[model samples]
Target: MASMNDHPGERAAADPVKLIGVRETPLSVDEVFRAVGDDAAGGTVLFVGTVRDHDGGSSVDRLGYSCHPSAEAELRRVAEKVAANHPVRALAAVHRVGDLEIGDLAVVVAVSCPHRAEAFAACRALIDDLKREVPIWKHQTFSDGTEEWVGAC
Candidate 1:
């Protein structure tokens, strides 16, 4: 057990939550992965979501992401909830917004735990909840020049 005199965040550091949001800039998977690296963690799982060239079998020209002002706050809330529910040693998540090209990373998340199963489960929950809970919208431009918006709060 860590003593109180240790790092102020040590005791609670088992669940370090890091939420990095890039509104107009590019998202860094390396940064997100590094944020969740912990010495005590026996396993770490990382998930990187990218923008593909097609969606629903339709050729997609490009895609864009937009977020509400409360997106970051909501992200933190979701991360906190996941950490509280799981034995998370560390957690990190980053989402990219603005115009994006095919093969661009739209989101990256990672979680560390004392065991491999725990790390996989916790990492899954982190990304699943983030995509559902965050007030982020996706704008897609199809090859037919049609556009559609999905998932906005």
Candidate 2:
């Protein structure tokens, strides 16, 4: 199988976790989950975020994600921070951008550690930090002809 492309602005130095990232195509949880698998890891956690049919009870027609040029850099920073706090064997995260239909996967993150709890915690932190800090915006169109854009200007 062909290798995944490197994340934009990712450093050359080797890291325990691979930083495969920010793209406009569909995301694959299986691909990312596999990247984090290691013989030494006793546990692995994967989190997948998908486009939902509704937002705050409003029916959604479609949604799209737009990422700033610096978004990948921010993702790497967040991932590194999470890695620093845990004994991660390997980790990988990918966030999809562009138009998406309901139920389409939006993001996938995986973390493998020596134990279950740490993997879970680190995976959670990695995702949370990425969402909070990354410069990615979500634009949604509702069935009622209204639209909303979330995240920074």
Clashes of each: 0, 0
The local distance difference test score of each candidate is: 0.85, 0.84
Q: How high a TM-score does candidate 2 get?
A: 0.88
Q: What lDDT tens digits, residue by residue, belong to model 2 across residues 1-153?
A: 224763322222237668569998888877897898777778889999999999989999989999999988889888888887887878898999899999999999999887799889989999899889999999999999999998856
Candidate 1: which stretches are off by over 4 Å? 1-15
The sequence of per-residue lDDT tens digits that candidate 1 reaches over residues 1-153 is 667665532334544796556467778878888898888778889999999999898999989999989988888898899888877888988888899999999999898877799889999998899989999999999999999898954
lDDT of model number 1? 0.85
Instruction: Using TM-score, give the best candidate's number.
Output: 1
Candidate 2 at residue 115, lDDT? 79
Show model 2 residue runs off by greater than 4 Å. Answer: 1-14
